[model samples]
Target: MASNIDKYKSDLQKLLKLGQQLYYAMNYEVFEDKFIKNIRTVMNSDEEVTKFIKDLPDFDLKYQPWYSESLVLIKQLLPDRLGDFIKYYEKPKNRKLLESDNYTIEDYLQGNIRNQSFKIATSVGLDAALPQFRQQLSILQSIQARFESSLFDIRQLVQADFFDSELAAAKELLKHKFARAAGAVAGVVLEKHLFQVLCDHHIAIKKNPAINDLNEALKKNSVIDTPQWLFIQRLGAIRNLCSHNKINEPTPEEVGDLIAGVDKTIKTIF
Candidate 1:
């Protein structure tokens, strides 16, 4: 399984290539046929867009023009483009004559409207009605540049030193086949980090919190959504089982899930 960072980098590159293709093709079909088909898979979802932007390295650098421009486009422009294209135009190529209507008397009579429509249409289709293809490509290009610089900011893919002690220790424990202990440590890390999330977001917290308490606080404070909150609630059970009952040993598989879940959860909140 690739880490989230690796997946983010991979998807960013793919979106970049798709943008270049759309730009050169200069046709609505590029968007209708290829770009739309893949963008959702590439970015996962709108929620993940916020995650990707947040996760990018050097996110605060002042000099990356593409990075900042892309941020604005992603948040503001690409969304409307994604929503309505051919459908917004509300007409299909098949409906129109294969050729222009023989330069009809009616067309000559209404020459100004005809001329504008001609500008809107190209050798392709009624692309004049919309230029979402261009908009999509523009945003993809911004995302590409941002990711490129950010990757450099973070250095290599395996930046284990970037992690805090508990997280790093849990990884080392897993490497040494200490699955049960790793599971416990991961639980502690999850709670501590969720606590940190509260502090970072300025959410009110009670003294000496449990996982349930932390998870609920996160949800109530709008730090995490319902689905994520629910998933971590299950992680809370695994943590409790591992920490509270010495005799009820967690399986390696369960511990592995615990580790992965906590890792992703923390990254998302951050």
Candidate 2:
């Protein structure tokens, strides 16, 4: 069985190949009369004429788009090109015939519009679709060229988003006067982020490492200098104060500082 990444690559290649084939099929329909003219000399027999006028395969044009999967990957990996990719496939509203008919790639595939003859005649059948599909194919190829690296970046992006949400939740807790709870939430984010950083650097650590443990490992591995190590130690102390020191409640200021420090550490360290 192929992995999702492998499937994604295969789908991209298939899309490009199929897009090219569809382009050729569309052109064959548009210039079919010209094809007959060029092959007139060879039409000596019925067999020759039949061979020469054999229908081109337009079945491939009905390819069910892998849109659901491709769109998700596009949003995550090539977000900048996402709009254009969608634009090429969807029917544009208030479109002019001079610009384009309301017809789109979807219309072409669904048989809602014709590529041949006077019925549903338009110059922008697959011509409009092919150019933009080629652009999308190029975008997919760029991602394929650096797939592993792009995956790593995606992991980092997802983690960063999670960390941001955690911090926001921590802030909401602090606003409700639950300083200890806020610090704990912030502490978890900091700890998880450090763990990820260690894994990224391939540094060995225990299954259940403390914030200080992760911090010390990072410092020992030279991932962070002494100053950063000291800063993290201070942040770790505040986390301990909030988590373990039930006798003394953490101040709002201390929890606020801890959250801010953790936010900075995750962003700067990684």
Candidate 3:
């Protein structure tokens, strides 16, 4: 009687030979639909097997001869079940192997099918989802970096005794930093609001000049502007003070108020 490993090997071989035939020989369109459906079903039904397959390295089986050999052996063992499928395995090397004894039909068949099924499924899903995932990730990362830098600027302002500085110098630095932070926040919020407006009302703005445009658009769309705009402006100024090493900065309390205001704005907008 075949051992569990042998049975698995046999099943794998049959599937691999079929996938190779479908993918290489017949072109991807021939059995892609059926192959994908069956693989998904098997993955869902067998958690352990799915895990094992997912854990395998992503390169050719030459790196793990035993695993590769087992797959090939499996494929040859199920010729009747996979003969039609082998039409897909039209690659020169694969075709050669199918006709050679370099690897057992059983092992080669099993490994190839299991690996190919996993490869195809993952490739298709990732290809479809990666762009959206990356976009969201980039947005979150930018938000995190902005918040961190804001906190750092606030700390430096307190240490520099900005509150005790001359009024003119302090005000100038304050304005600069405020603009910077406002711009960052505006960039995030405007994009979001504009997209929403376009989707809901079929209204679109081809170009955004500044945060003012976003504010006006929001007002036009019946969305209330958040007080956070003021805070973002303040944060931008604080950022400038630190960047330029300006003398006489705003008080910690004043900066705190700005940050709080911006946070409030974010809460309202989001």
Candidate 4:
């Protein structure tokens, strides 16, 4: 079985390769004609141009899968770059033709724009997208530069995959009206995540720490700020109601909130 670090390294490399392919695709669309023209004039040889063209790696980008996966990783690891990374991809809601209505890569990928026209060039969005892809690639490269220290990130990513699966199971339970069971499942996820966070911060664990105990430990150690501390405290209360309280049944709505809250906390806190 591949260890978490190896899995993380592989994932990062895959993202980097996909990003490079996407960049190549966009670059080819934008400058292939110019490149061929320049190379033909400079080399004055058809054989050389044919060889160059053949050497270019063939790539057909299924943009959404790469974009979605990279977006999630950027949101987790390098959140400051997330906005710009998204800006180049998501289509604007209100596009003013003469104003700030620049086309996006999404428009090009979705076939919403022309290949060549008198109005706009096929490279309309490449200007924005190429730099963004480079930036995201840089983010991955920097992470790869320091492999050992990134184990924490790898652990978080690995745990995130498990948490997402468990939450999906909880969602299925909720859909069947097993509200208490769903809440219990969500509460367990939250508790397990909190324990993991404690371990991440190297906090000493007590025997059988409850959600409240873990929350308090995190708060007292200044691992979480006041607002986050209070938020976890509220989650602990909801978890208690779901796990221990036996009088009133947990509403689907409340259990839904618990599941959603757990999801957010697990994604954000680490």
Tens digit of per-residue lDDT, candidate 2, span 1-270: 454456556766775565555554655555666656666766787678566445444534343454544665575556667787787677666553422434556655654434354344545544445455555556666666656573445566667777888999999999999999999999999999999889987999988999999999999999899999999999999999999999999999999999999988876784
lDDT of 4: 0.74
lDDT of 1 at 166: 66
Model 3: per-residue Cα lDDT over 45-94, one tens digit each: 66754553454443233223432343333232322323322322222355
lDDT of 1 by residue, 30-87 (tens): 2445534454478878787556434433311321343333333343223333333223
Models ranked on lDDT: 4, 2, 1, 3
How does each model score on lDDT? Answer: 0.57, 0.72, 0.37, 0.74
Measured with C-alpha atoms, the lDDT of residue 197 in candidate 2 is 83
Q: C-alpha displacement of 168 in model 3, angstroms?
A: 29
TM-score, candidate 1, is 0.49
Best by TM-score: 4
Which portions of model 1 show Cα errors greater than 4 Å? 1-11, 22-130, 143-177, 196-202, 267-270
Error of 3 at 257 (Å): 2.3
Error of 1 at 86 (Å): 18
lDDT score, candidate 2, position 269: 80
Report how far residue 6 has shifted in candidate 4, in Å: 13
Evaluation by TM-score, superior candidate among 1 and 4: 4
